[model samples]
Target chain A: MSSTHIVSIYDEELKYLSRRISEMGGTAEQMVADSVRALVSADAALAQKVISEDVILDNAERQINEKAIVTIAKRQPMAADLREIMGTIRIAAELERVGDLGKNTAKRVIAVQSSGMPRKLARGLEHLAELALMQLKEVLDVFATRSVDKAKAIRERDDEIDAIYTSLFRELLTYMMEDPRNITPCTHLLFCAKNIERIGDHATNIAETIYYMATGSQPEGERPKDDTSTSVVTADVSEASE
Target chain B: MSSTHIVSIYDEELKYLSRRISEMGGTAEQMVADSVRALVSADAALAQKVISEDVILDNAERQINEKAIVTIAKRQPMAADLREIMGTIRIAAELERVGDLGKNTAKRVIAVQSSGMPRKLARGLEHLAELALMQLKEVLDVFATRSVDKAKAIRERDDEIDAIYTSLFRELLTYMMEDPRNITPCTHLLFCAKNIERIGDHATNIAETIYYMATGSQPEGERPKDDTSTSVVTADVSEASE
Candidate 1:
């Protein structure tokens, strides 16, 4: 083949990979939103849908990885082109994880379906999910636009999700303590919330990948963190109850 | 440059990537073991050490990635050699996440530190951790030996970790419901167990990667999964109590 023909084929291959990433991102985003909605509304059907749809993201990741390896072998891309391909691989992996977290959340719906979540607790979780979804959406856009500035902004915003998760963690523990009946359902909700919190972290991971793809270096400094529930000790039951 | 000199350099590059992966594997294994020991014994100092050591794995992943990208750009390897390079990248990422799960488990040590976990609960968690660590070690060995049969075996054994984790999940929830005082520490232990289970999952992931690197095709059939904790509903507190 002529050099021009080879170049066009390579370009088409790259575009195909990008389109796949975009499709994976959309599916991941919807799964996150739908999982949280299922939790809040106790919609088993939606949760089941999210669970089955996860294979789409899983397959997308595997296909992108196969295509990426093929492109690298055939094109022997160097420098910027190589970085873009590597970035897609990493981004696709992250989105696949995001899908896993969503499926995990949906899987818990069955556990809480019978007991039903309290509105107050559901509201707290909903608020946290919204922030996480916002972060996910913004970072996916950054991936598409290759905007370092917005990516940086999304990285900083992760602290918001962490903070919300910490608070919700405390609330769930307190509720579980207040009534033994709440233990099983609350445990499931806590995991679901943790799943959403991790979704936010994946978005941050994608942002970092975008930065590396564009600038050829990792983001400066450590990513911010505020999820302190790990060290939290509710020693005073009375205080927690109040 | 002579053709032999170029070949040797290319060989050296590939060797360096393998050594890095081995180093990463060793570190991740140690982290998983140390974190579980810290949790079982409530050793804050050991937990702190595990937390600090995570950066080493993170840096190793980044360095391996950089070298692999350069090797591909410089050597332009094809077929099996290219698959080997991509395999290293995927393996490094999995090890990095295993390190993260270990670090997250270590972070929870403080929450259960003061209260001191119940001996029975600790034993249950220890049992689960042992299974997960065994899985991790086996998979890392498979990565080194490139044994497709061993990889397939490890993939099947994931169900063992999942089964143990599901039992542990029920035990922790039961402990929490039996006594309100156990709520705070039990919650932390629950998450710790979940983290270990995830470590096992990463090991299975590594096994799959090793299989792909060896055969250029994904393993047949869906992976065996028995972690029914997601859908578990302990509605009858009385039943859980017994």
Candidate 2:
């Protein structure tokens, strides 16, 4: 083959890889939305649908990985092209985990359905999910556009999700402390919130990956983190003592 | 350079990749063990060390990833050589996540330390961590030996970790329900336990990767998963009302 024809074929393969990533990103985004919708509406069928659909992301990741490896072997892509292929692999892996987290939230629907979840708690969870979904969507967009600035913005906004999660963590604990009956439901909600928070973290990771892929270095300094729930001591013995 | 000379250099590169993976695995395993020990003994110092040491894994992952990409570009390795390089990248990512989970466990040390953890609860967590650590170590060994049978066995054993985590989850919920004072500590401990469980999941991921690398196909049948904690309901309103 002529050198021009060889380069063109490589370009086409790269484009196909990008398209696959976009499709995978779209599926992941839908799963996150539907999982939260199922949780808020107590829709087991929708939740089950979300759970079953996770395999799509799994299969997508596997295909993308195989394609990237084969492309490298065939084209021997170097420099920027090599970085893009590697970034695709990493981003696909992150999206797969995002899908997994969404499915996990869906799995909790059955448990949350059995218990009567309070509107306040359900609303809190919904809000967190919305934020995480927004972050996921934006990062996916960043991946498509290769916008380092937007990626940095998305990275910085992760603290917002973390802050919300920490507050919700405290709120759920308070509910659990207020009534023993709330423990089962609130515990599940806490985990649901946690899953959403982790989804946001994955989005942040994608953002960082995009930044690295574009700039050939990591983002400067650490991304700000505001999750202090780990060390929070909300229940005082004297306060809870009757 | 002669063809033999070029092939030998590629072999050396592959060996270096494997060595880096082993070292990264060793650090991840130690981080897991030390984090659990810190939690059990309330040793903030050890937890701090584990937290600080997580960067080593992070750096190792980046180095391994860059090295693999470069090796592929230079060597254009085919078939099994290509799969081995890809497998190394995937396993490195899993090990990095294992390290993250351990550091997260370490981060919980201060909160668990303040609550005066019950001996029984600590022992439960320690036991769970032991199983997870064992899984991690065994999977790393499987990676080195490329033993597909051992990898499959390790993959099958994940349910044991999940079962233990579920029982621990219920036990923690019961303790929280019994006394509001236990809420904060139990919540942190619950997350710590979750982290350990996730470490097991990562190990399982590594085993699957190693199996795929050896056989060029996934292990058959769905791996058994026993973590039903998501759907578990332990709080009975009637029982608690009295």
Candidate 3:
């Protein structure tokens, strides 16, 4: 942003777009934290609040997209400028998806209103939430500062969230097996845990975007894919489809 | 794509992007079908083929994105033209994610190599795959034809996939409970089912993009959300976070 340009208003448009993205990042972070709280407490009211707040995140994304498109039309930015603007659109879209994940998680607070969640796993989920939110915050900073190193660090931490999620999946399975009663509520937590895990993924996606925007080169090498959710298939057969 | 323009090359550029997107969509649909074949047949080699083919989809998306941005920068397309290019970008991105889902589903073929999957569930997954691919095929046609009505119809069908997924979830859970040994494989199928369901979601997203591009207006009313995953939360209390 500091790269001096002849047209000051071009700079202004970019700055305004950045500000909207910042607002979106902040809202997404709050939505994550609040959704977890509502989940743990089964506070439907708080869950409702998280749902309503998603509109703000959506609005923020719209503003950023509109401004970015208009700026592109007006400035006809290429290479770095185009990448920078496209990066905002990508980040804003990721943030909005995060908002949806939060809303979906928050909705779970009301979904299991009859049976209580496993008390023991509450700490585990909170720990996972802390890890994901930390990642979200760090990625947002990377976006603001255009720090490739910071973006890479955030990208690497996505595995830690996945690890936590993998373990939680087993624990929930055990709970369900030990008592049939645990099945209903634990399944809810399972999906919610996956939601939080996916939030970490969005952060990683943003980190990649920031790195590409700054370097004009995508970070090389495959992203670490440690989520063992893939290991669930086995022997079966079906007639082939044309 | 057929509208004659003063700059014939501009039309050509847009057509090329569209052709790439169509290729991507076709490849993604094939990947889904192949992944299911691998899953049902427990054919790791076929799964590997599906996994390997994903690069084609990814490369298609990248090509479309780069070309679209360049066209916009050079053409400075406004209104419908701008929306057309942006829509291609959005659709390609969605197609890429669909490819990822297919790859992940294919990977499950390798993950479940240790044990045999339930024979009963293969049909369930194939059914889900059929529905999703059908939706994908229909939506791509909508994009090609620029038919908002077709897009709207595809959007409404998303709930049907969700409904099928919810039932499949129950069926898998029941299978797991009836036999503890079923847990591992059923869990894998559970993730696979969700992945297929998510493919339907990407199709719906593409439909929305088509709707917007054709009409220059986002469709009104809430998207049908019938996934029973939302009904899992209940009463609980824990120390809330700041």
Candidate whose TM-score is highest: 1
Task: Give the winner by DockQ: 1 or 2.
Answer: 1
Q: Would candidate 1 be rated incorrect, acceptable, medium or high by CAPRI criteria? A: high
In candidate 2, stretches whose alpha carbon ends up further than 4 angstroms from where it belongs are: A237-242, B235-242
lDDT: which candidate is best? 1
- Model 1, position A220, has a per-residue lDDT of 95
Quality of model 3 by C-alpha lDDT: 0.82
Q: Candidate 3, which segments miss by more than 4 Å at Cα?
A: A1-6, A111-115, A232-242, B1-6, B110-120, B232-242
For model 1, residues B54-87, the per-residue Cα lDDT tens digits are 9999899999999999999999999899999999
Q: Put down candidate 3 lDDT per residue, A23-60, tens digits, no spaces.
A: 89899999999999988888899999998998898778
Candidate 1: segments with Cα more than 4 A from true spot: none
Of the true interface contacts, what fraction does each candidate have? 0.83, 0.80, 0.51
Score each candidate by Cα lDDT. 0.90, 0.87, 0.82
The lDDT-based order of candidates, best leading, equals: 1, 2, 3
Give the winner by DockQ: 1 or 3.
Answer: 1
Q: What tier of docking accuracy does candidate 2 attain?
A: medium
